[model samples]
Target: MNKVVLVTGANSGIGLALCERLLSDDAEGLQLCLACRNMQRAHAARSALLASHPSAQVALLQMDTSSISSVIAASQEVKLRYNRVDYLYLNAGIMPNPHFDMKAFFKGLFSSNIITMFATGEGILTQKDCLTHDGLQSVFATNLFGHFLLIRELEPVLCYAGRTSQLVWTSSSNAHRSAFNVEDIQHQRGTQPYSSSKYACDLLSLALNTHYNKQGLSSSVICPGFVMTSLTYSILPSFPAFLWTLLMPLFWLIRIFTNTFTLTPYNGTEALFWLFKQKPESLDPQAKYHSLTSGLGNNYTEPRKMDVDLATSEALYEKLLQLENDVRKKLKEKQKESQHVMHHGSFA
Candidate 1:
């Protein structure tokens, strides 16, 4: 039997790199599905992957992780196309209007926390988040809730009696417990919605393991470290792309102190690809695997224990379920309104 793998946000960056790696690893018996919002980019990604591995099975599914309806429709499409999902990579995420604190970076450089700041990007970075059409925080919706809903929707294909399925999330080192609040799960009042959302991914993975492990489904989260993708380049938008190239030497210097600077998307996907080859049952649920690059440019995966507890994880799982129910109600109402508008418009 052929293994089926579906990856969200697989058009570019680490997601795309992971796809390439998967094909390179097993081009014969693997069916790859690239789930992306942009059909154009998805086509390009499929073409590029085929260019290298012409015999590889690569398909595309259109999905916008920020939209509830889009996720639902895409899930239906997925179930229609594939009976079983061997691997699901929840890699879609967004960090909007990022603001880098150069002053804090400099301060941390002089302080004893320089290594931590560089590794985690905790003290020197923030993002301005907005509300989605569903009235949820855009960062939270794109990064956490959307993926959670996708998992819930695909439970039938993911959970089987004898077959095991794996879920690998593209989490971040910036996922801090301090940024997350159990009361405001959406981070509506916080400036660090990106961090909060990633932290939520960590907790949700644990919850998923607890709930679905008995059903032959396993979930794990990974931090790609600080890869210089378009997402990272957006942080310093004013700086030209060439300027980032000029700073490569500095990044290498920092890599000596902090191995989190994986730099390229391929290197950043080390842990994701590593997880693909592992038995899900043997993986650690309480750990967040990290993709690390050394000063000499060697890449490896490291498992680090996350700062989460079972109580918090279970509480977050319940909160997400409640939010999912609320969103379903809202979507049903919107669909009915659309049908009603069409019914009245037909008479006109």
Candidate 2:
């Protein structure tokens, strides 16, 4: 039997690299689904993957993880196409309008926290977030809630009695417990929405394990470390691509002290690809697996304990369920209003 794997944000960066790695690992008997927001990029990624492995089973699904309706529609399409989802990679995320704080970077450089700063990119990074059409924070919706909705919608296919399914989230080393608040799950008033959203993912993954483990479904999270993808390049938009090329030596030097500087997307996907080959039942729920690269460019996966507990994970899971209910109600009302408007317009 062929193993089916679905990856969100599958067009580029770590997600795309994972897809390529998965094909290279098992080119013959793998069904790969590339779920992306942009159809053009999705098609291009599919073409590129197919170019390398002509006989690979590759398909595409249009999904904007930030949008609730899109996720619902995409899940329905997925259910129609595949009977079971062996692996679901919740790799879709965004760190929008990132403002790099040079003062903090400089301060950390002079302080004893230099290693911490370089390893995590914590103090130097902040993102400007916006509200989505659903009246939720865009970063929270995209990174956390959208994937939650997708999983909930695909529960039937994910939970099976005879076999197991795995949910692998592309989280980050920057996911800090301090950034998340139980009351402000949407991070509407927070500047570090990206960090908060990822932390939420960490909590949610634990919650899913608690609830779904009995049904033969397991959830895990991985931090791809400091990868230089388009998302990272957007942080210092003023710095041209060639300048980044010049800074490669500096990045390599940092890698010597801080192994978190995986640098490339292919290297960053180490933990994600590692988890693909592991038994889900043996994984720890409280651990966030990290992709690390040594100075000599050796890549490996390590599991680090997260700053989360069962109480907090359960609380977040309940809060998310409540939010899902509210969003679904709003969607239903909007649909009814649209139908009512059409009904009245027919007489005119």
Candidate 3:
């Protein structure tokens, strides 16, 4: 039987590659759902995949992770379509209107390789959409809170299914512990909202593992090394990306010394694809997988320092439950208010 897989942001990048790779695997067939915000792009992606593997089962679902209504609607659609989801890949994210510092970029170029890629703020950028539909930062909403809610909504299917299910989150090496402040998960006080969002995802993944693994649901995180995806293209201007592309050979050499220098989407997604072959119990629930590249351009998978504190992870889980309840209560109150208005008009 085929496994039902739901991949968010499957229209492009690692999500698309993961869907293609899953379809190519011979162990089982896949009922792959590409949950994306853009229907046209999702259609094109679905068509392209079906062209190569005509027998591939593909479905498109419109979802904007920044909106609570969109998440709820998409989850309801999934519940109606599939009895169970064996795999859930939370891959949709945003770095809206990133401000890349060119001076920092050149300064890091002259520094040591590690500093150039990891420590320095050259490759780092700032996002603009700190406001979401839920009054949170758009980055945190799409990357963390929205997906958190999606998982909550789909828990019945993922956890109580006939078989075990896996939830893989596309985290980042740049997700430093300091980037996240428990007090302000929205990162309203900082310019590095993307990093903050990723950090929150790290904590959220840990929380999921701790809370739900015993219940037969497993959650893990992976850093899709620096992928040259459409996301990257959008963040950096064409000229910079082109320049970075030209330096691809140098990047491969750097990958030998620094694991975070993964320069391609395929290599960046290696860990994500590799995890698909494993049983949930065999994985390290507390660790985040790193998608690394070798010196010769070969892709490899490794484990990096996962900054997961159980206390913090648990705290976040409780916070999420409160947020979910609050959102539901607010929605119910609004609906009742609207109904009262309608009833008065009809009586009048």
Candidate 4:
């Protein structure tokens, strides 16, 4: 039987690159589905993949991870379309209104923390986060909660008795424990929602492994390092695209100090693609795999122990479950209210 692989945010960047890589590797053995908010881009992605391998089984599912209703509806669509999910790549994420700290960046440049700053982007970056229609933090909703709901919704397909399903998240080296607060799991009060959400992904992966491993479902997270994709372009909206190309030499120089500058989507997807070929049962729950690029431009995947604790991860899992219940209840109430309005208006 052919393995079914579903990837969220597979329209562009590392997500799209991974799709291409997978098809190039096994167009016949793998069935690919692109779950994206923009069906237009999804179609383009499908066309691009088919341009290479016309026989490749590529499907598309419209999903908006930031919306609770959209995620649930998409998950239902997925369950109806596919019997089993072999690999689920949770690559949908957003980092909006990023403000680069030039002062801290220059200070770190002359200080001893330059390499650390470059690798993790800890002190130099922050993003303004908004709330979704569900009243959850947008970054948290798009990057973590939506994926959580999808996993829960697809538990049947994911936990098929004999076959193991792998969940690979596109996490980040920028995921900082300092940005995350247990009390504020949604990071509503934080300026670094992107970091907080990625950190949550790390914790959630471990927690998921604990709960789902016995049922043949495994979850892992990967840091794509610092890839210059459309998301990166959003960081410096003032900078022209050509200016980024002009800085390629400087980016290469930085790669000598830290291998985190994987640069391109293809290079950044090394860890994600590597995880696809691995047996999920063999993966370490406490580790976050990273995509690394050497000075000579060779790409490799490295597994690094994450700074997450089981106690915290489990606590987070519990909070997410509670939030899920609350959201579903509110949704049901809203649906009833809408139906009441429609029924009353019919008589009017």
Score each candidate by Cα lDDT.
Answer: 0.93, 0.93, 0.83, 0.93
**For residues 230-273, what per-residue lDDT tens digits would candidate 3 score against the true structure?**
77777666456568667666656666776666776667789999
Q: What is the C-alpha RMSD of each candidate to the true structure, in Å?
A: 1.4, 1.2, 2.2, 1.3
Superposing every Cα of model 3 onto the true structure, what RMSD results? 2.2
Residue 140 of model 1 has an lDDT of 93
The CA-based lDDT of model 2 is what?
0.93
| lDDT of prediction 3 | 0.83
Q: Tell me each candidate's TM-score.
A: 0.97, 0.97, 0.93, 0.97
lDDT of 2 by residue, 228-306 (tens): 8888888898977797888788778878988889989999999999999999978999999999999899999999999
The better candidate by lDDT, 3 or 4, is 4
Cα error, candidate 1, residue 238 (Å): 0.6
Candidate 4 clash pair list = none
Q: How far off is residue 293 in model 3, in Å?
A: 1.4
Which pairs clash inside model 1?
none
As for candidate 3, its clashing pairs are 130-137
